[model samples]
Target: MDDSIKPNEDIGACIPRLRRYARALLGVRGEADDLVQDTLERAWRKLHLWRRDTELRPWLFSIMHNIFIDQRRRAPEETVSLDEHALEFPVAPAQERMMEMVDLESALRMLPAEQREVILLVGLEQLAYKDVAVALGIPVGTVMSRLSRGRERLRELMEGRQRVVALKVVK
Candidate 1:
């Protein structure tokens, strides 16, 4: 047994963020949970090596992040379903709002990995810029750039839909 992992210690603190980041990165709830489980298992196995002074949540997140990247490289053409329970926003009372949310999810799925990670980390997870920089092992400027580019891409997709709707309205 690894000295670093205390059997009763709660590693659960990191699970929600891990699941959220994984879902955003993989664009599928089921696969994301599987990835999170893999991360926890690996973390548990290698627990003895973990530095006591370091924060465990970020360590787990970094592990999950690397796993997501590696999986993408190994499986280039995989299509993840975004309909998982975690990714599903509440059922909106208004149908139009629900459709818009669906469109937003679709746009998120279309983003490149770098852009998606940045947006998920900074925008969704609300991590500090410094923390995200450290976790991503990238400069803070890169995070800003990816978030900007991702938001622009999302805007373009949404605007394209709006334009089509407007055209139909005029006709």
Candidate 2:
């Protein structure tokens, strides 16, 4: 097998996992797909920075995580009115959600982005804690704490326990 082909194959195999994570994290098909495209482009351009000794999957995810963080920090770019360009927008999926999954998705949406990333990485991707740390560029302890907090919050949301905050009154 040619060495070039092997590397391409490896990267190709990871696309599905990246798409799944992106979709879960972003909750929109178009945005998720765009993120995946950006990730692959970045990975290909920075392939030299990747160490041969380390696993490629985690490194690819790290690149993706960094890109996502950078995008979050920047102000939104020029907006296109979807209503005016309905032909440009893709049709939404026709699948109907079960009640439980809808609730779960809504609950996931409510989570802080940090907690949501950690939970989806660990729970949905089934990545090891160490790999998650590497992917997110955080320590293992941080990943564990985020995952723990996220899971607890998810359970609370699923159980319909709304968190109440007591507002201070100054008059």
Candidate 3:
């Protein structure tokens, strides 16, 4: 068995878990799959450096997470137009609610990458503190701190949204 092929196979086996992690990170299923594919591409490119005995899943996840962060950093902030004709325009009441979920997911995307990453790892991915620390290349204490800060930021963002709604009601 070629040594390089073994690592590629191991990474291939971890794709499902990586996709799940990416889904939690990006919220959009398609975007998550794209992130997973990008991670696999990066992993395959760096196969020679991968240690045989080290865990592959976390390394793959870390790659995915970093790629997400880099992409977010590089993306331009464009204002979304609210043209009615442009919107898909869901009619069903339940569908409207689903659209709101998508809006919430978009808001989540706006969060700081470190906070978002921490929330996805601990809250969504259900990884242990130690594992998350190892994957993030940070101390377990740092993981806890990031999680706390991330939750607080999320709460503040939600509260601000509520205030806007309340103001509109008062008007």
Tell me the tens digit of each residue's lDDT in model 2 across 78-120. Answer: 2333432222324436434444566687688788889999999
What RMSD, rounded to one decimal, does every model reach?
Answer: 3.5, 7.0, 4.9
Global lDDT of model 1? 0.78
Q: Name the lDDT of candidate 2.
A: 0.81
What is each predicted model's overall lDDT from 0 to 1? 0.78, 0.81, 0.73
In candidate 3 the C-alpha lDDT for residue 41 amounts to 90
- Each model's TM-score? 0.82, 0.79, 0.68
Write candidate 1's Cα lDDT for 40-102 as tens digits: 998888777667676666567667777778888898886655464356545899998988987
Give Cα distance to truth, residue 171, candidate 1, Å: 2.8
List candidate 1 stretches off by more than 4 Å: 1-10, 78-89
Superposed on all Cα atoms, model 1 deviates from the true structure by an RMSD in Å of 3.5
RMSD of 3: 4.9
Candidate 2: the clashing residue pairs are none
Off by over 4 Å in 2: 1-5, 76-97, 161-171
